[model samples]
Target: MSRIHSTHDDESIGSDSFLDVVSNIVGILIILVMVAGSRAKSYVREPGEAKSNIATAMDAEAAKADLRATRRTAQSLAGELDMLTREASTLANEVKAAEYARIQLGTFVATTEHELKKQRDELDDKTKRQHDLAARMVAARRKLDDLQREQISVVSTAAPEIVVKSYPSPISATVFTTEVHYRLLNKRLARVPFEELKDLLLDERRQLVWKLEDLPEVSGSVGPRDGFRLDYHFVRTVRGGSLTAAYYIPVESNLGEPFAEALAEGSQFRRAIERLDRQNTTITVWTYPDSFDEFRQLRKELYRLGFSVAGRPLDKDSRIGFSPGGSKSAAQ
Candidate 1:
């Protein structure tokens, strides 16, 4: 019984030792499998890291190309800006020069205008002086012509005599055998125009009078008995190596009846004569200073008509149809 108990205890001890050994072997196998799995994961991570590094290098190259293009554009823009700045400076200088030229032209025009005005004033003064000198020269020429006429008259051998007479004297008994009337306008004795005298000479056929020198009575109501009768003798004379005509006119007629009828009703002379008696009434004419030449011509006609005429002289400035105290002559 002792032997059997000891053997059983030995068998139990052997079995426990064998179980410990098997557990140790299984732990070692598990450690080996974990180490292999960790190594394989490390290999896969190495390939991905290499691909990421290549992509980074390509991106750096692209960024370099873009920077170069940006730099070139900036340089070109700077050059264009410099050229525009220079053109702006040149235009500014040209504008300043044009302004200076305009100022100079304005100054020159002002000076020219002043000179032209001065010349115009001088011309007007000269023209006025010239006109005054011309007027003086004309007056001198007229005086010289009068002197020549006087000299010619003094040297003439067959010239008519100059007769001077006074007026407003008593009329002779035989003077009122015939009478005539005439007029003065605005208190001025207006002369007969030379053209009217020339027309009268032409109408009377003065050439026929030249042939009638041998006849005793060359004029007496030959044709129409008008207001006048002309008896003229034309004399030929050689003066200054030229043949000249010298004529003498004599008016011989009684123009009383016709002249009285021809006088207008409203005339001053007609009105005056109507208030006077017909017999032995003396007629007096008021003469103006301007009528000296006309009076001389009219005196001959009155003398031919067998009428004695008297004159009272008045000033040239005297007003006609005016009385004292500002009254009208007709109203008075």
Candidate 2:
């Protein structure tokens, strides 16, 4: 029995050792599989890391190129900005110059206007002075004319001495009596221009008294006119002797004569009257001092010299002898 049991136990021990060997093989196979899975995972991770590194290098190159381009553009922009600044400064200088010129021009214009105004005022004053001087000259001329008229008052606007009468036969008196006639006159604003005439002018048809019968008779009338005509006839009369009678007014004046000649003319007149010369009408001009006593002296001298006409009588018994025979002789 012991031998049989030993052989059986040997068999069992072989079997147990075989089983233990199988278990150890299975554990080794599990460990190898896990190691293989971990190796494969590491291989995949290494490939991803190499690819990532390559992509990062390419990105760095592109960034460097972009930075260079940005720097170039910045330099160009900075240069353009400097040019703009220079132009702006130049324009500012021009504006300042223009403003200064405008100020000077305004000042000149204002000063010129002021000078023109002053000149105008002076011109106006001169013109006014000239006008006033002209007016004064005109007034002075008018005054001189008036004085001249007063000196020759009797020569102009003289009343006519026309005789209206009838002869023995009234029809004969209708004929004209005088031949030579003249008129001198002028227009006046205030008083009659009695002194405006300078010289006596005769009509064309009546130059000589002998032309009486042939003289034309003036019939028309005008204002303030003195005119005359004449007629002559040769007829028989009953009277054996002829009588001469004439009427006239004689006035003498030294108004227009020079002072030196006036005295000589007065002396000649006195001599002629003393000798009873051929003149029928006579008047003496008396010169006296400009005083009241001179008027009396002139009257006394006139009476002493047989001349008796005065503007007014200053003494009694004074008389004027105009005609040799007439009412004048009777009154004296």
Candidate 1 stretches with Cα past 4 Å from truth are 1-63, 157-332
lDDT of 2 by residue, 31-138 (tens): 655554565455445445657754455544554555555445555645655565565566556655655666676677779989999999999999999999999999
lDDT per residue (tens digit) for residues 219-287 in model 1: 321221233322233333232111112121213333222333324456544454556444443334445
RMSD of each: 39.2, 38.4
lDDT for model 2 comes to: 0.39
lDDT of 1: 0.46
Give me the displacement of residue 246 in model 2, in angstroms: 63
Give the TM-score of each candidate.
0.29, 0.32
**How high is the lDDT of residue 223 in model 2?**
25
| Model 1 TM-score (2 dp) | 0.29
Q: Best lDDT goes to which candidate?
A: 1
